[model samples]
Target chain A: MQKVIQFLILRINFIIFLFFEILALILYFSNNPYQGAAFFNSSNAISASMMDFSSNTRHYIELQDVNDKLAKENAKLRFLLSSKIVQNDISNRIKNDTSTIKKFNYIPAKVINNSTDKYKNFITINKGSADSIAVGMGVVCFDGIVGKVKSCSKNYATITSVLHQDMLISSKLKRIGAIGALRWDGNNAQMAKLFYIPRHLEVKKGDTIVSSEHNSVFPEGEMVGRVTSINIKGDENFYTINVRLSTDFNKLSYVYVIKNKFKIEQDSLESLNNLGKNESK
Target chain B: MKANDIVKTALSFMIFVIFHVLIVKYFVIGSVGLCFFYLGFLLTLSLSIPIPLLLLISFLVGFFVDLFYDTPGIHTFASVAIMFLRPKIITLLTPLGGYDEIDEITISSMGVRWFITYTLILLVFHTLIVFLMEASGFSYFHWTLSKVFCTTIFTTFMICSFQYLLFTPKS
Candidate 1:
């Protein structure tokens, strides 16, 4: 013990350094990607405002198109509301529907920051703490499901864009109920991969895919993209499907933050079930 | 001690964070990418700072990069490792009969080969630290191979190109 103490004192800094490093490694493997992003979370408002101002120039055109799209959607929504029976039927169908398990509420906002050339992709939005934007919310632009909520600040929050390498989405085919996980290969912005789908199911080109309702990030049936190619890698038991994204992420201006009230309940229940199964074994 | 150094450190830290965030969150080339992007934090720091401040600055630099990149302690761990090993890397590249402590160093003064060699060695160390941190002990061999090959090559290119573009060449 005396010799060990002397040796430790000789390299106290080194020991402390190694100690801190090991702590960091433990945190790294713990699956909390939000660990170190807490620093420099605040950026100068001047740079942010300047960025927002520059975005407004390109946003004017999107506004006009957005107005047209909103008008069309409004007209449809109004028509449905005007018919009480139709409204009742839609609500009843939603209540009775058992295929999809995910639920969501969307809060609309404008994109403040966007980048595409990097490995991890994130988008900053104008709405944040004040707008009740929290970490873990899902962000979806007109194109499709963009990504999950990463971090939140007073006036802003970052969303993990689907174009990111860390992007993982629960998705399924619209025509067939086959479900899988969605990920990007960091090669092309136009393409992503849908893996873990069993090969027994019949999948084809141009098949529409959407959120699988597996998690509370996005509502089920939200558009993802269409399958462009499929490869079965020599009895791997899963079909690798290449997907072309629907949302033109490069030209994104506005998005909606999806909130799920049932997320907590659902996650806890799932975890409990998993734990129960593990204990049983 | 100078105001310029302080401001430079703060500004550079932010840029490094943004660069790291973009790559990890957006460009994520996977295991290969995690290594390259994480190096941006350290490479940016080592470029302009005084040498004696290495261990202190490198520790904080690693910590800061780890924070922004969401890699937990990977940045902190790797950076400190490099800080300790930086002296050795410099020693290896020191021409025969020449000896200079790390404190007396900058990019322009060092010839191109020496500079590149210096940064490459640091980058290689940085990559090893990061790749190991990311790899969940699931499949060690494949992860180790991919991490080393992909990061060594990719980080070399990125570090070289970025340093070339950002720094002013001396006459």
Candidate 2:
């Protein structure tokens, strides 16, 4: 008993150090990728406020560029509204139709902090659960698709940007209608690779890639990126196509979170089908 | 003597942390490397302080920095590890006269060569742990290594300048 006590006393520092190191490792491993249990992320109160305060100072500096982008979006929205009104009149005459419900809502949020330099980058936005933001919601800017909300606190949310290594978006080429999954290779923030696309499909540089209907997070046809290059590894089943992301993550300031109204219904139906399959088996 | 040491250490600790988070954190070199002059806090901690106290202080400082940096517990892990290893490092690099007889740990108290060597060793060790944790894995092995090397050089230079220009050796 005395020997054990002496042994412990002799190596007490090492024991204490091991205890703290283990605790820290637990925190790191637990609060990653999923981030569901992460309370110390940037979206948390202290970090979010610090970033918010700094971003507020920077906001005034980029006012001119922000204004230009807003005006351009405003012009495009106005044109779309006018064209929609004409279509409504024509559709009303053609067939008196009703029953299609609104499927998506956009919640405006300002990005408080963002980084494009890391392998797994995240963007912290000023809106969180208080503003109806939730995990898994798609976030988009005026230009194109941004990313999905990974986690949320009371008044802030973290977005796992498309540049992140783990993020994969279902995408389709507009010109040739080829479908693939978009993933970042951890090299460049501006570029992503589209995988699982067959070489037989007619593809070209500058082909527009958009979010596919297959993805539950994003609405179909929302711009994802443009194909920059196609690399066909000898006799491989899939062509690796490089894409230039539409949304510039480094300069991102404002974004809109997509709230899909039909998500609940679609998810329930899918789960019910799974249940039925399980029962049959 | 104890009261005076306490006051001096506290003041320096606050300055190191503030300097790190507010100023140095913003200065990202080439968008990859960052200067961690705040590590001066750990490097300059008085040798008379106990191992347990040092561990606690390092954890607190690391936690505070993590709160600002949004890196969760990576800093805490690195800081605590370095604190735990500090005694062993000192023992290994002990001068013929020994560290037990030394008072303050400023560069002036310890000769410039010893100070430089000591600071560089601990700084590199801490930075390596931090970069590895931040990268999350060895997947970005090359990138993480470059980041570690760049930050080590940058931080070593900064710490040397800080010690030479700002730090006043206790008379």
Candidate 3:
């Protein structure tokens, strides 16, 4: 007993070091693509407040650019509203029962903190559970789809940016309607890779990619990016294509969090199908 | 350590944490190089600090920085591993006559060559661990290596400049 006690005391430093390393590793692995606990991330109260202060100060320098973009979008929207074709179509459309039902709600929020240099990037926004911003809701800006909300506190939420390594966006060619998955390769902030695009499909540079109906989070036909390059290997079955993301992650300011009213119903119906398959098996 | 020294250490700790989380976090150069100037605090800690205490301090500082960066355990693991290797590296690099009166690791206290060697060795290990863990695998091996190399150089330059500009040599 005495020898064992002496041995343990002699190596206390090593033991403590091991203990902390193990604890830290657990925290690392558990919080990998997304963190389950909100307190450990920037969305927590104190860090979020600090980010809010910094963002408030930095917000003014980019005001001119933000105003320009907003003006352009406003002009486009106004043009659509004033067009005779759109007005005539709207007036002649028959009233359908399903058309009256609201499917999605948008909540405007300001981004307080954002990064694009890391392998996994997250955006912190000012809206959270208090504002009806929940995990898995889609976020979009004026240009294109941004990302999905990953975690939320009472007053703040963290979004998993499209630039994140683990994020896979279900997208399709806007012209040809060929579906593929878009993912960031952890190298460039402005570019991502599209996979599962069959070689037989005709993909060309400048082809637009948009969110497909297959994605549960994002609304259909939301702009994702434009194809920049395509690589076809003799041995590979799928074409390796590169896309230039439409949303400028570096200068993100304002975004809208989308709440799909039918998501719960759709998810439950899908899960029921899976349950039936399992029972038959 | 004296009471005065303890107070100084605490003050510097807060300054390092705040500066790192706020300013240094956004100073990424070309998406390749990142400056982790906060590690300067760990690298210059008084050599007499026990290994256990050093480990604890590094873990806390790393965890705090991680919270702001939203990289939970990545920083903590890297800093802790480097701190554990710190004492051993110091013993291996001990001078011929030994570190007779030197209490802390600084360029003024130790000569430039010794300071560079000590910090370079530790920074390489620190950055290697950080980038590898952040990458999560060998898949991005080449990209990760480039990031590690660039970040170590950037961080070293920042740390050296800060030491020269801030700390005065003892008479």
lDDT of each: 0.73, 0.86, 0.88
lDDT tens digits, residue span A65-117, model 3: 88998899899878876794676678767554563246778898999999999
Worst 10 residues of 2 chain A by lDDT: A34-43
**Taking the tens digit of each residue's C-alpha lDDT, what string does model 2 give over B1-171?**
499999988888877888889888887899667888788988888888888788888888888888888887899899999898888887788898776567677787887888888877887889889987777557688888888888888888888888877767656
Task: Please give the lDDT score at residue B3 for candidate 3.
Answer: 84
TM-score per candidate, chains pooled: 0.51, 0.55, 0.54
TM-score, first chain, each model: 0.76, 0.83, 0.82
DockQ of every candidate: 0.20, 0.29, 0.27
Q: Lowest summed-lDDT stretch of 10 residues in model 3 chain B?
A: B8-17
lDDT of 2 at A72: 95
- Could you give candidate 3's per-residue lDDT for residues B1-171 as a string of tens digits? 788778867877766667888898899988989999899889988877788999999999999988987788989998999999989898899889988787878888887788778888999898898887777657689998888888988988888888887787666
Where model 2 places Cα greater than 4 Å from the true spot, the runs are: A1-43, A94-101, A274-281, B1-171
Docking class of 3: acceptable
The digit string of per-residue lDDT tens for model 1 on B21-65 reads 656345545635533554554554533454446566766767677
lDDT of 2 by residue, A185-238 (tens): 999878999999997887889999999988679998999899899999788999
How do these models rank on DockQ, best leading? 2, 3, 1
